[model samples]
Target: MRTWARTGSGLVLGACTAAVHLLLALPVAAALLVPALRPVAESVVCRLAGLERRRIVVLLGGTGGRAEPPPARALRYLATRIPVGLLGGAVLTLLGIGLTFAATLLFSWVTQTPWVMEREAAVVVSGLLVAYYAVPGAVLLYLALAGAGGVARWERTLLGRLLAPSREEQLTRRVEELSRTRDAIVAAVDDERRRIERDLHDGVQQRLVALGMLLGRARRHPDRAAELVAQAHDEAQRTLVELRDVSWRVYPAALDTGGLAAALESVAERAPLPVRIHCDLPVEPPATVRAAAWFVISEAVTNAAKHSGALRVDVEVAMVDGRLRATVRDDGRGGADPAAGGLAGLARRVAAADGAFTVDSPAGGPTVVTAELPCA
Candidate 1:
């Protein structure tokens, strides 16, 4: 039906154009006579002479811009400049018609017909041939314009189809980006852990060992060494506290002991900012989930205490449909863009344990980061 409608429309357009043509050409004598006045004839002759002169000059002078300006100075000059162009085109068209006649005359001669006896019949035949040639040209011109429009529409549709991402491809691309970001974060974390370990070993641990030796030497002295031994004892006690702190940071014992719940509670208690904890867990979660929860809580609490200008924070942990759900909400100014990098590390650490994470932070005083880890 659509094709039929288009075909009908094209037929109507073609018929209208043909009717207009027939109306214009109805008076053929007038069509061929109006542009043949004396001035028009003279203009046509001048243009032919100017064109021939330009061609000869260009050939002789090799286009060196060296020729005197070709006769360009009158109404005739104006004709040479402007009307000349139209006049020349008309003469060329007439010449082509003359050539067609000459060819017909030659054929007539070869067939032993009279030299030019049937002039009226020859003119009518030539007119009919020119008229028929225009029909297909008009059709082709219309189809060309239509085809160009269709091609533009098709190009637009193709571009739209190519640019839009498919769901599966979008997921695949997102997963790839996640993998790259995760690997970079994990590498950075391992580097930081190693640095911290090295610092403790070279600095604090060495100082602690020296302090212990000093305490042993003070004990060996028998004369008036009690005060020295007491001072050494104080130093040794301080060193032990530092060592334990560094040890806890390497891996907290509570994470392996009571479970993620108790570990998170310890983190909350340790937070410099006021912290509220709500926990409703079941059977302590899986080992990896437990570890993830512990780390997330630790890092969140540390970040809140250190940077977030918040007075209070809330930590919530619960099992919702076998998934370990935990959230940390801070009452702080909170316009966070994850692309700025810190949260990327948090994201990967959770993802490594096969968890889902979300962050919701408004402009002021209420930021929530929620995580869900597979209990399995």
Candidate 2:
């Protein structure tokens, strides 16, 4: 590179320098190698000239010469290797220089020009041309190569010292952590199911069982039997609805092969008030995304049915701009607060999936729950 700088023109040298710098910026120096390659290459050329070496020392010192020096041993090693080293160096350097010209030839052809013209121009150019231009450019690239090699050496040593893992290994650890988190989530869901089951057996289920007995006994009351039967029927119906909801919360069957639409339809059908469903989304959404949509809609529908007191509910779902958008609004009651447990859980779940959840429940009867999810 130093020799090239001393001999070449500015434009060519400048390009060489830029390329060297760019390569050095990378993690590995790769082709940025020591001058040793020059001689080894030249040895092949020497064979044609019928030259022979007893043995060749590629270089004088250690690979990068970072080892501790032992003067006596070093002297002995150098003395023995110097003659062979010289022959190797001359052979390789000549080869390197020759290959460099070969490369120039190929480049000129690829560029639709002639190498002879460029070489003539290079030969005519003065030190000022070479020094101020080409040589400087070559030097820049050489320095970059040296610097990159030094950096790679440093990185290996540093990583060894610090015991840092490779990129893939670190990511593997992260995946394991996320897997643990998912496992915990599954466990917590199961626990919640047990609690809901207990609540049903202890609270709503027992009430309905008592109601059934009351109605049976009511048949014997001659005077107020008609009114008693009516009350019992109403109570039983309410308990049955509550029981159905608990199971729905545990799992939504419609979320399977039939997809989100089916699950959503079931929600609307189950709600007490009339609901208009507007679903023009893709028939299938990703499982997690689809599940998120299902939960969010189910929550919104339940909220509308119980609190909004609205006469009609509108549920709209569609994928817009690579996102799943769902809007649920009720005309019954207007005000809803996010701090409430129901909406809060929905918000957290959507956020976990890197989606957006919002509620626009204004006072006085039009409450809209809007959730936007990135399904893609």
Candidate 3:
């Protein structure tokens, strides 16, 4: 029943589409002959072509491509569709006639009308005749539907070829992408600088001021001077540690000295969660790619440890097919979103280096974040 219904629907839609294209094609063809109306008619045809493309995509389940900028490709697509639409219309007409004949035969038998046959026949004989007409009519209907689908598929292929991006368009898209990514990179750099400045001012500067006051008090009270000196020394050491941490966060020196593997190992050691690092890379990637890889792993681990109530985290870095692939997995509560805040920033950072970043965090248990950077 469903199949029959779909067939009926397709036939109707095919007929309608065919009639519309036929009407539009005549005006477009005539307009081409008249120089004054050619451009206006072509523009109208392009709009109609867009409508046609949408119909093919939605009703026929086809990915009809779009022409870049100019309407020449669109014009060609419109011209080609005319014949295809006419073919569909013819099939629908034939199928409709067959179905009508079968319905009329059934109605005649039901009413005992002598329109179909002059005399009334036996029950078996009537059933046999009805089956004969109905079977062929059903086949015709199915064929009509199948033809519509085939034509739709063919049209999609044709449109794809006609509308495929030109070299100029491809280059233009690349330039735009680069421009957007560059702007994002600059913004991220500025944000990082501001954060570092705030951390230094609020944390290390206050500690240093308190340390200086302690040292000055120690000079005035010589008896308790030893205790004050020790306290002042501890404060100085803590300030140094904080400064080093800030510097590392900005750009780890370990990346230059020990390569990406060693740098990732240091990250694992610092993470709040018991992070296990497994890195296997024969050589170092480009500086930019290495930095992006480090950021991806570090951020992923930090996010997991902070948000996920996880016992352990795992980090894996490998070089595969001339690309650096890093994955950070945690056994904790998931549901990590990649669209906003920290994750979104990380995505932009990776994209700036022409790398790919992905996060797979469901709900209950495990979260996985993967990044791939071209080592070449």
Candidate 4:
């Protein structure tokens, strides 16, 4: 029922657009022939094409990313599409006529009006006459609907072939995108390096300096040597722990030795809040993909622990149609900004790996971060 309704709606919209195209056909051709009016014609045609592209996407589930064709190509498209639009309009008109006829036939039969056959006619004769009309009416209705569907497919194909970007244009766009991705990766790497430097200076290095001071004090004063020595030992242990943490932030050894699951498990265990992890993978992803997934999860978990005020986090990783999908959800205050510091870096990292990353964090609720990376 839903499919029928959607198809009916699309056909109606297509018929309306076809009428508009027919109305514009003469003026557009005349304008294109004049050099002064050529730009104006091109502008109008581009806008119309854009509207049709959007219509196709919304109604027919057509692929997007339509590029405006050149003026010459636009004129050719308009010329070619007029006839196709007429075909669509004709199909819709036939469908409407069929529906009207069926409605009239049923109405006249139900009310026993003389409009259908006759009020004095025999029942057997009336029944045979109605059956004779009904079978052909049904077949015509079916043909009309089928024609509507075929017209829709033809329009989508024509639009794709005429308005889609050329191969050279596509290559240029890809090159621009690759360049931007390269720059973003470089910036992210530099940011990571700076963060590591700050951590070493403020955390592990500070602890090492304190441990050195404690040991020096013990050596200088023998009367309190045992107490100072014990303090130095405790400080040394803290320094080692801080060093380990810094190293983990730089790059987890578990990623290389234990794979993505083990690495994520270690993260879950160390988080300040409870973290539930579910990982199901048919095969191990490439190393780059694994690293990208791990970082996305790790950064999300860290942000949740530090800023979200969340009680618990959930992490799920799986293989979906040859892509590795990793999702992290935290039950906390939302409002995570993807354009801001760490999240922005994560986006760039995912882009560098040719993956898609999304952050959904509405106000006063849970936050969800997801990354999809191609493993093939």
Candidate 4 to truth, TM: 0.82
- TM-score of every model? 0.47, 0.41, 0.61, 0.82
Report the C-alpha lDDT of model 3 over 193-304, residue by residue, as the tens digit.
7878998999889899999999999999999999999999999999999989888887899999998888988998888879999998888888888888998888888888
Each prediction's Cα RMSD? Answer: 25.5, 18.1, 8.8, 3.7
TM-score of 2: 0.41
- Output the better candidate (1/4) by lDDT: 4
For model 2, the run of ten residues with the poorest summed lDDT: 52-61
Model 2: how far residue 83 lies from native, Å: 58
lDDT of 1 by residue, 136-237 (tens): 655654654454334333323322333234467679978997787678568647854775788698768887777777777777876747876777778777
List the pairs of residues colliding in candidate 2.
5-135, 38-92, 39-92, 42-91, 308-333, 309-332, 310-332, 334-365
Clashes of 3: 0
Give Cα distance to truth, residue 241, candidate 2, Å: 8.3
Best by lDDT: 4
Instruction: Tell me the whole-model lDDT of each prediction, alpha carbons only.
Output: 0.59, 0.60, 0.78, 0.84
Error of 4 at 138 (Å): 4.8
Tell me the tens digit of each residue's lDDT in model 4 across 1-376.
7766776676677778777888988998899899999889899988777777777777776674465667666666666777777787788887887888677667666776554334466332345566879889988988988888898788778778877778898999999999988987898788888989999999988988898898899889999999999998999888889989888877789999989999999899889999999999888899999888998899899999998889999999999999999999999999999898989999988988888999999998699999999998
Determine the C-alpha RMSD for candidate 4 after optimal superposition of all C-alphas: 3.7
